[model samples]
Target chain A: MKKLLLAAALSALATGAAWADTVRLGTEGAYPPYNFINDKGEVDGFERELGDEICKRAALDCTWVTNEWDSIIPNLVSSNYDAIIAGMSVTAERDEVIDFTNEYIPPSPSGYVGLAGGSVDVAKGIIAAQINTIQAGHVASSGATLVEFASPDETVAAVKNGEADAVLADKDFLAPIVAESGGMLAFIADDVSIGGGVALGLRESDGELKAKMNTAIDAMKADGTLNTMLVKWFKDAAPQW
Target chain B: MFEICAEPRSLEGLTWLSCYLTTPKHAAMYYSILTVLGLLLAVVPPILFLGFAGALARRSKIAPVRWLGVGYTSIVRGVPDIVFFLFFPIALDQAVEYIRHKIKCADVLEPVYQGNDFVVCQAAKMPLGIADQFYHEAWGFSLAVITFAIVFGAFTANTLHGALNAVPKGQLETARAFGMSERQTFWRVHMPQMWVYALPGLSNLWMILIKATPLLFLLGVKDIVYWAKELGGMKTQVYTYAHPDWRIWYFGALLVFYLFLTWVSQRAFDRIFARASRGLSVAS
Candidate 1:
């Protein structure tokens, strides 16, 4: 029994050592198109496909891990995962804590969705945005009453419930919702482009891994596979290389 | 689900609500109630065992054992439960990872702490990075259970200690005069009597435990509170079952659910209290 226990422990250690070589990709599975949990309960969306392709191109073993969006960056820094591919927009504030590979998806505009025909002055009226997003930062600095929610769904709900005059979020995210709202929702203001493009977030110490991923992203861009995925997921809004 | 649920946006009134209440997300919400109940049921045995051991340790003749028990109860009871709830899981997670990092990455020379980051090798992750989603969820739920047990066990210890003392000294003396061993006297006279005094405090603790199930959200377990906030928020036409901001109704449902739990708990405790107090000379 003692010998068998020792053997089991040794094998467990061996497996743990093997796991060290695999890069873990952390993502927020709540956001659709970028990343979302499909009905099958696996991470399935644009980023999931892109991340898998990037791993294959880099010849690196990788695994997907879902994390809540609020702690995605902190968790990455804390070694909860090797990199973040959670549709995170590159911002100077974020770059202070972690490094980013070159942007895979270009800057998408942020737009305000509101009840159709409502007089929502974007500069002064109450606006809702997901907490810790570029839109929330913009609204907070723009002198509007910014109501921040933890999820994108709640921001839209805020607009519909009359809790806020409008909700500012990614145009790609809001456009589909607005179109499908049956005229109950519409763009209330001009789109505002903020932050750099979306990129994979990595810890500052993981420069080798970042370089490997950046090379993979560049390869995809050069081969047009990247553009095809963008077009498939974002449709007309996709910024082709 | 009804056929009208196929085009949920087209329906209104009771039909829409009927369909809305049974969406997959709502179903998940309903299942989360079981998560709360499971936590309660799983936690009780550990709590009672810990409480019993703690009370006995405090009553021990050995000085160090008594101090150990006293220290455990006092330190845990002194801190607010919310603070413990927030701190324990993160600290425990990091501690586990830190030990794993030491064992798994012995060859790595770099220190684990670099500035604000608690950098550990990928192998040191609590659930291996490649593990399925169910494993991750189970790991988090397990951590939540341990945390609840530790915090609530301390309170239970203090209550049990007091109840042990509340058992009459004269009854124990009579048992001793009849030549009963100390162990026999405790089991026959003291332990049975201790329950009557302990029941009131235990009942209060149980009610608090039920209410504290909502705090599982803070620990990142998808308990009912997490689902309530997620499902109750307004879903737009992009969703299959679009709804207006119905958070009030969703939270209202949660309100009723919690009230029902406490109401049932109150009746159950009352029956237990009456049964325990039976044939005793103590005033009802």
Candidate 2:
């Protein structure tokens, strides 16, 4: 125990850190391309790899914790974890509650997808969107009847079940489903951009930790690593910042 | 699982079925079901003990003690258990932090409950902001368990109190005629007779507790319901073992599991009731 305390002290002394003894990286661990748990029950995805790299470059000892997306930010304020590496986009509403590092992945607008030969109109039809998402916010004001689900996949299911005429989500999240559906579905309308790009969420009080993570993110963008990771995860649709 | 499960496309019929059932997430789901059973085993004994104390307290001669016991039983019985289960953990956590806030940051305190937010000082944070990841989970789970215990304990008290009254008055009178002390007669005769009456009610409580285990998911513990959603979602090629949405099948399996569990409990309770009421004239 004394040795463990010494190790913590030495790390704190090395980093000149003012926060905690160890960094806890929180993520939803359910959203794909950004964060998700592998079959091994460990977090594995773009955000997991990116978070590790950031932690390494920042010289911080980090651990990962999985939380549901709905209460992710509130839990952060409650001090359940130090940072959220989940795919949360930076929005003015969210910014009021928490700070974000500079965009890690640039703004990727959402698109509406529906069945082919269907009477769905993005402007007037019943739309399905994941609750608390930018797409949901867009639909709320689009003059379209909106149905919200807990997860992104549920919105797609809603479209398939004829519960809604279309679903609005990140094209990256929807593209695989559209392809896997064997030409049953197609994009109904153009993309709608809402919030700024995804970034690591941090407590507003942790300015020093935020600075450290921003430096790591900026370095990845400067090098080709960030783009490579985007291509590796999001494939051909990888957005260039 | 069949050896042919190595190729997802090559497999067909039962081979595919076997392979699909043995996925890591499926294994985790199985373990999560057992976690509910484990919680019942861990929680039931303490709940029963609390019930016994409350029952005895209700029978106490002292006015305040009897009032405490009566209030506990009545208040909990009057409300739904799930309401308490949902309400207590967050309320208790906030109550703890509020007390700590009052004690620790007594000087420069702003209003803690500000509009929609509960803004306590960093020092007043339960498990603290800097505590380890495991510490946070442990704190949340302990709160859940306490909530479960407090709610079930009240019901158990009510049942045990009823059983105490249902015990034949002649048994106590006989003990008194034999020159036995009040405490001795209550412990030796009344307690044994009370068990025969209590067995049916306690078994019913056990079944309800079994059903309530699934609510652990709502309290933030990664139980069976959480795993069902996680494993049953559609998996794209990005995942190691890609599959279409199979949530219906997963939840169907859970349905069968709960059916079997309740069946086993019913059979076990019948045997226990028969044994407890052996050589007794009670209509249990």
Candidate 3:
């Protein structure tokens, strides 16, 4: 009688755990054309749609949450969210800290886009970038102040203020900045590029959930949903997975 | 590399005229910095006042008031201000929602944090999930400004408190002997003298504030740093305006701008300092 009662209690606990179906999704709304808040104040863009599809495919109720680009990783580790669909590149270094889905998006090169103006000869010593960034690493390795700004707006603002010689950004993101910045900048050379593409991030402990996501993503790619979403957002610039 | 032209050439004389100073967007970023300046200038004073309150509370006579003040000041100081800067806006955002959540989503049976997500009913959404882009930006900016004030206010309080105390004890005693009330002494005798002592500390705080302005990026506010990173990246030949390797130039421009601002501020502070010290004859 005691053994039977103990088994009954264990079964109840397992049933309670199995009934949970909610999932939390994270994104860096800062990255546009991937995931950004629309004028409607709703999360929109390719990653946003893709995240929704994944939840639909997995049959889990999901909610979208936005976080800053810098703190997204730390927040993920703390279980601030269950999954991250931000335009996070799956770098080898980052892989050591968190497991990722098979590259949801393939490698895309990032480079600085500046207004056309006076040529700067920074080949031997000078590399273009703000005081912080992977690009800044290029300058710091060579030992320099590495120009710094507070935001994308300020970076372009520097050119308008005649305070900065150029600005750095992803090659794909330049068009919008150029359009919005009121001609303060134009295209610089695309010689130097940073190779990485956004991927879905998951905590390593959630192997079960990660496997589920991978399957859903694979199905999306197979069914042409991924391509369709990319074209809707990126037009011709949408990268292949 | 450092050579200069005798006259800043017009579009006619310069060889790279089309390449330089020609993009329509480039012309607009100039005015944008004014907006950035406006944000900094408009937001800082209120923060100072807030800091003053926090500091004064810590020095209060009532134990509870003193404890509250101590808590505010210490909480602001203990964590890295960056963490506070990032966390406060989101936490405050959630707090606003949570309050709304209780009123609008009173029926939510499950906990707010289920595993990792914070879910509130539609009625409880802060800014109502359907607000305009401008409203969201404004809300975000206001939150950033408040965070700035809360964090910096504590430091300002510490400075102001010390300044308030540094007024010689004899001055307070003399005021009392003259039959002036404590309030009157604080306003006339102490308040007036406190600035002279506070000037040095306040000026230092101001410099720190200037340095701290860059962290606005972390707050999700679209400040100048955001634009720099946006415009400084490399672009291909397909782009409207094409050049080669210009991020160093963009960043160099920023360095000069900050240096100029700092230099001008130093000059202004010097004038204020001299005026504040005018009536004193104490030996160094």
lDDT tens per residue, model 2, B1-284: 44666675566778766776786757878888777877877787779888998898899999999999999988987887677765778788889888878876788456776533566766667766666655676677777778778888898998999999998899899999999999999898898888888888888888988888878866677788788888888877767667888889888988888889889999998897887777788653
lDDT value, residue B155 of candidate 3? 80
**TM-score: the better of candidates 1 and 3:** 1
Could you give the DockQ of candidate 3? 0.05
- Candidate 1 per-residue lDDT over residues B1-284, each given as its tens digit: 66778877688899888887877667778889999999999999989988888888899999999999999899988999888987888889899989988987898888888766678766778887767667777888988999898888989999999998997889899999999998999998888888899999999999999999988876767888877766665554435665555678778988999999999999999998888888777626
| Residues B51-90 of candidate 3: C-alpha lDDT, one tens digit per residue | 6787679778999998988888777878898888867887
For model 3, state the Cα shift of residue B22 in Å. Answer: 6.5
Task: Return the DockQ of model 1.
Answer: 0.32
Q: Candidate 1: where is the Cα deviation over 4 Å?
A: A1-17, B1-34, B57-67, B78-82, B168-170, B173-182, B231-264
Q: Ranking under lDDT, best-scoring first? A: 1, 2, 3
- Candidate 3, residue B260: lDDT: 81
What does the lDDT read for residue B186 in candidate 1?
92
TM-score of chain A of 2: 0.89
A1-241 in candidate 2: lDDT tens per residue?
A: 9999988964553343244546789998877867887766788999999999999999987899887777788777655677988888899999888888999989997888999778777889999998887889999999999999887777888888899999998888788778778788888788888888999988777778899999999999999899999999998988975
* DockQ per candidate, 2 decimals: 0.32, 0.27, 0.05
Scored against the true structure, residue B24 in model 3 reaches a CA lDDT of: 37
